[model samples]
Target chain A: MPNDTLLETRPVPGTDKTTAVAVRTHALSKEFGGRLVLHSLDFRVEPGELVAVVGKSGCGKSTLLRLICGLEKPSSGWVEVGGERLSGLSRHARLMFQDAALLPWKSVKANVVLAAPRNGRRDRAAEDALEHVGLRDRAHEWPSILSGGQRQRVALARALASDADLLLFDEPLGALDALTRLEMQALIERLWLERRFSAILVTHDVEEAVALADRILLMDGGRVTFETVVALERPRDRASAEFTSLKEAILERILGRRS
Target chain B: MATESLSYRSRLINLAGPWLVPLGLLIAWQIFSGSGLIPRRILPSPLEVMQAGFHLTLTGEMPMHLWESFQRAIVGLMIGGSIGFVFGLLNGLVGPANVLFDSSLQMLRNIPHLAMIPLVILWFGIGEPAKLFLIEIGVFFPMYVNTIHGIRSTDPKLIEMGRIYGLSPWQLLITVVLPSALPSVLVGLRYALGIMWVTLIVAETIACTNGIGYMTMNAREFLQTDIVLVGILLYALLGKLADTITRALEAWLLRWNPAYR
Candidate 1:
């Protein structure tokens, strides 16, 4: 356990002390009205591992994200982040929603500042995050006035601005147009390289998982059916035969596996 | 400047929309009365009503009556709306609290609030309190329902985001819940305000000595159709004024909403 190992790694960023494990889940099970959603789900996300979760519709991938993020309580397991229990202490991570969940009453800057400190450093952080997301110019505008892509950028900024070491993305770019989606995916990859944080991305797109994840967890019938690790280099060619073969392999595994 | 000109034209059209029916009715009424198609006493000329309206405003009597009714309605609205807002917030944020009051309150809300007139007067006498109570009852329910609906209707995903960000419950309420609930709450308030004015007339007619409602009642007794017409016009004016203010305030508060954009 990372919880026991946290003391060994000192001088933790954003904390005076250090933590062993960034995130740990043990036999995490979730059910709704006796219908099994997630069963005996045990997973460990390293301090800065970027994992993509791919699954068919209604396969409990989003539910796993929710459980990890503490949005929904687990039926019979524990989720700990950076050596702290999640149930009592609302985990200080951030989630980027498909809807961009920006409070419609606040300006872009205010929305970004919502999770930041209330001082000079916080202001600088928010400004830097917006700049990083390419929304610095739209910081003062209402979210309602922004384009769909711009709004998603702001939502991404809000998540990235959080001091937490973990980020749970629940199909944050599923609603974007194709052209914008490419730009966003590249930007997200760039951001991930710059900011080393554990990210668990829940998405339906096989290509998205292959393109972004260091390791992809393929879930079927509320269980991890296959675990795939991309050995391809960074900025990997999407059209390369190797990439196509990998995608095909994952697809076959997805199609072949039956509950 | 280009967009502004187009917007100005649209603004004029919007303003003119509501007046079309009233303006046509006015022309029809004037022609009917002037041509003796309808008896003067029966239809009453628009000119006569206008004259009466002018006289009532120019003199202190009608103004005083309007002020009295306005005062009663506003006071009841303030009290009733405050109660409704508190209950609504409680019902929204606290599950057990909502369960405690929701069903019983819902049952009580079904009774005709207007029919409480005799009982209100019996308990509180013919004083201002009785009339105010009646109007307050009218204002409470709509505001309460809207409050609960607004609060409960908040997006769970956003709320989860707040929690994941380590937001305290109070922080959650102020940041996420209030903004989400605002549109509904404002709508409820507008409905409550309109009903307050309506209930004022009923209460005033039953008990009060001087008000717009009392003025209309007095005019009916004296067979002065012109005065009655003036009172009705004043009621319409006040109701429209209240609605316009609420609409403007809603625009100001929810400026970030895409519907407004």
Candidate 2:
């Protein structure tokens, strides 16, 4: 399998030295009212690796992210993050939803600062995060006044302000327009490159998965049906022949065609 | 620049428009009363009411009555509002509290607060306590109901987000729950203000020897229609003033809401 080869070849830059594995799930399964949603799914992500999980609707991709983030419990098996079992929300992980999910009552700065660690430098950290998202000018504005893209940027700022090692994204850009989605994907990729945090992105868009993730895992009937390591270079060109071939390969796997 | 000036003019017109009807009514009443169509004793002219208001003010009687009434309203509002806010928050957050108190409180709310005046008067006598008690009841239900509604209506998604962010229970309450509930709580406060004035008037009319209600009643006994009209006008003005202040507070507090803009 290419998995072992990719792991051996890929250099994980900025990974914390003390913890080599960022997330690990062992035979994780979840059942909702006697119906299996996720079935004994075993997965591993190295520190600083941006992994994308893709599947059709109701294929348990989101459930997996929720499980890893400690938002939901597995019916069987368990999840480990940073070598510790996740019982509830751990300070080491942060999940960003599809909706910006900014608290409408708070200003952009406050929303970000609220999630930050209660150190004296929280305000400064929030400001820096907002600056990174190109939203320092709109820090005082309410989320209600922001456009969808701006709100999402603020949400990004909130996530960035937090010192979480593992970032879980549940279709974080699924609501945006085509142009905005592309911009957000680039922004996410840039941030992931800079921060080098371990990330698990659950997305419906295969192109998005190929563009941002270092590795892509496909779920089918509640199992990890396919996985591929995208060993392509950074800032990958979508129009390039190599990028198209990799995307097509993943799509074929999802469609159950071996062409 | 031209459009900006035009919009500013339109805004000014909008501000002035609401007063036109009341001003017109006042002018018409002044002319009709001066023309002697209605007996002066029964419906005093607007000018006469203003004169009475001025005379009462000059003698300090108006201020005394106004001060007394304001003190009672404020004291009762503070006492009842705090209790209602606490209870509402508790019941909304705790399932057991809701199960224990919500239905019973809702039942109590249906019984008109004014209906308890007779029992209240007997229990507390016609002292300040009775008036305060009546006003408290008037203010409590709206605050309590709105507080509960506000707390219950907080977005579940926001709560989930808060939890995932590793917020403590207290932080979640302060950051997410309270702000979401504030708009509803403010609505309740406005309603309670309205009820407070109504209850005050009734209590003063029925028993009290002080306050604007007392002044109005005392004026009626002496057939000083002008003074009675003055007292009524004062109540209207005070009520409007309270409403305006509350609305301003709501605007300031909920400035984050796009709907408000």
Candidate 3:
């Protein structure tokens, strides 16, 4: 296994200051009804880093994201955000799910505004977030009328509206069709580049991992068994040899373990 | 010319589509009653019923009875509906409240609310309270059951999303849970409206001195079948009106829902 866990505590590329760590888990483990789902493990995410966790279903990828977001408690170890131990649901973390769980009763902008920080100008925040997702015109439309991709965009805008430092994505694009998936991937990358919130995306698609992640973690049997950093430049070419090779290597590792 | 005539026919059907069945029935009824196929004392002609309605309306007698019935239904509905709403909210959101109330309420719901009429009369006599109590019992269950169903039907995913977004418990109930429950709640309200009229009719006919039901019973004593038919038609019309109002409420509240839209 090529272990490239060397990048640690590094300052984000565009930012000048060495920011605090976005998330850190010390021997984190979780079990449900005496069934161990996530084994004891250590994990870290740097500020502004986009970490993608790719694994087969039920391999604890979703559980890892849930634990990081404090939706689930660690059965053994503790999770830290910004170097502070998390006691409950992380106030600093925002989560986006695969279903784009927008409130069906609220307008698109109202849905976004519901997540806006209370102390700020919520309406303006909602407008800015919708504008970022290119959904300014759809602010007044019901979520039910939007396409699947557009709903996810609104969900993204909602997460963005809340000025959280960490964003946990649980297979946010898994439900979209191929073309829409590509468009969403580009949009996510552009937004991540612009905002630079530390993001942990749990996905099954290795290509998506290669395309979007700063570092890719492969989990099998409830443990992070392989780690690699994507050193590719911005606007990475999927057709390029480096991208294909990296994608193939990860797919092989995942499928290789299945047999 | 053929296509144009067909289009004209279709346009006319579109204009009169909803009235066609009722109009046909009315015409057939008029012919049968006017031709003396049925005894006038048993089932009066539609025209006679209309005349009775007009006479009652002109004398302001019908309006007074309608006002009394309307006032009773509205007051009973307000009290019963609020009680059901509060209880349903508690039972739906709180585990202990559900455990304490759900099964008992379900048991009570199985018994016909009309069956409690004798007991209600015994408790409150033939006064306004007796009529009000019957309407309250009739209206309570549908609202309670539907409210619980609505709250329980709320998508768990949306609640999780709300929490992750830092919505307080109160905010979650207001923004996510309540909106999710609105459609089901509206359905309950419509069902309750039906029960309200049914209860009032029975109570007024058996005991009350005023209301549409009392007017029908009074007409029975005088053998004025026309007035009786008028009262029956009034109930049907009021029921339809209640349904329309409930539907409009659904459309307004659930405009975001594609089904309602």
Candidate 4:
């Protein structure tokens, strides 16, 4: 298998920065009732980079993603994406939740096209998005009628419908069965390759992080604890010793204490 | 064990049980009166009840009373149900406006609409307005609560999905929230219509010159037990007809839902 992992840190122009950063947090801190959730955090990502954010539950993984997505206000810092500051970009860019949040009453197609501009060719775009997600045959089915995987597919289709530049995912596949999760990972990776949306996925699965991420950003104590550039090849064989070695190395870094 | 057979038999027995008691009660009354255990006038035979019922039906008087009753019920349900639906939808969806109305609504709801009958009589003088107001009050609260409950219970995750997809707020409410709320809202409508029927009977009994309630009351004064029984039976029949129609509408509207089938 061909090694597919690629990492880039070239920042974009403007905002007095020399390199292109898809996402950046500058000395970010968040506090809730004087209890600091995230303290003095700084991070940056290049365009089209698939960064996996892994952390134990309640380690502020979700909060970090929410902050970047502008769903929550930071205590005292800023998030920037695609050279546009968080305060500046339109609401088009944001996160996909863990739950398959397809509206129960909407047909698969309608859910996907929900964000399509009124002036845009909604019918065509909706159909195309559903097709991309391999749910074309199920377009007319209500979300309530769909199986779990199919509903998640509609949610994925909904997120990608806008064809936005930045995508934040917080444990989007955490609720799925292992088999379904594997299929969804492939679907997502394929779309990432084809569309090149700068993506961040938050998950606790070390194997999943190494499997699909360009660089795994392991977080602890609300800070980036470890960054691993997955060297495994495309369609990486899970049983292969080389992949296992890489996985073990990342696992040690994720679970083991810092020197 | 014979658990499965026991369950089957239990269900069968329960289904047939209610009818059996009524039948047995009728037979005992007839036998007792015929045996002179009780006088025929004091404890009338089932035959006497049937004969009186038949007479009223044949005379067209029962039909007349029933027609009036049904007309009032239909009018009240139409006016009250529609107004309730509109206001309920408005209160549920419009947050700030809902807050503004909530306290006042809660206060007004506390005063039982039935208790206002005397005041209503004074205001409207035994006419349509008083009756309609009673029915409207009966319908409003259940619809309002169900609508608000439905709106609040919508999955927040679904709203987030709409946000990610860039759906406008209006589109989200129409395509997502409203449809998700439909089943509960329909339940409210069904209950409100039931209340409207009850309210119509009350309104008719108070000041109406027509309707089954008045006829039944009049029959009691004249000791016309048969007319009274016929009126009661007619109310049940008409109520059941209305219920069946709504059930049919519910089935038709929600045919796409597996639960409906």
Per-residue error (Å), model 1, residue B63: 1.5
- Write model 3 residue lDDT over A1-259, tens digit each, in one string: 1344434434343222223247999999999999888899899999889999999999999998888888888999999999899988998788888999999989999999998879878898889889988999999999999999999999999888787678888999999999999999999999887777889999998999999999999999889999999999989999999999999999999999878
The reply for model 2, stretches above 4 Å from the true place, is A1-21, A255-259, B1-9
The reply for model 1, stretches above 4 Å from the true place, is A1-21, A89-92, A118-120, B1-17, B35-37
Arrange candidates, best lDDT first. Answer: 3, 2, 1, 4
Off by over 4 Å in 4: A1-21, A88-90, B1-67, B94-99, B252-261
| lDDT to native, each model | 0.84, 0.89, 0.90, 0.77
- lDDT of residue B179 for candidate 4: 77
Which candidate leads in TM-score? Answer: 3
Candidate that scores best on lDDT: 3
Candidate 3 local Cα displacement, residue B155, angstroms: 0.6
Tens-digit lDDT track of model 4 for B138-251: 888778778777887888777766655666789788877887788788888788877888898889888778888899788778887666666676777777787888789778
Better of 2 and 4 by DockQ: 2
Who is ahead in TM-score, 1 or 2? 2
Estimate, for each residue in A42-150, the C-alpha lDDT of model 1 and write its tens digit: 8878887889999888999989887887778899988888777787534556677788888878899988888675443667667877988999998999988898889
Tens digit per residue, CA lDDT, model 4, A120-165? 6777767777888899999888777887788778877766666566
Candidate 2 lDDT over A68-138, as tens digits, reads 98889889999999999878766677888888888999999999998877854789878988988899999
TM-score ranking, high to low: 3, 2, 1, 4
Q: Residue A17 error for model 3, in Å?
A: 14
TM-score-wise, the better of 1 and 3 is: 3
Error of 4 at A210 (Å): 0.6
Q: What i-RMS does each candidate reach, in Å? A: 1.9, 1.1, 0.7, 2.9
The predicted structure with the larger DockQ, 2 or 3, is: 3
Give the Å shift of residue A210 in candidate 1.
1.8
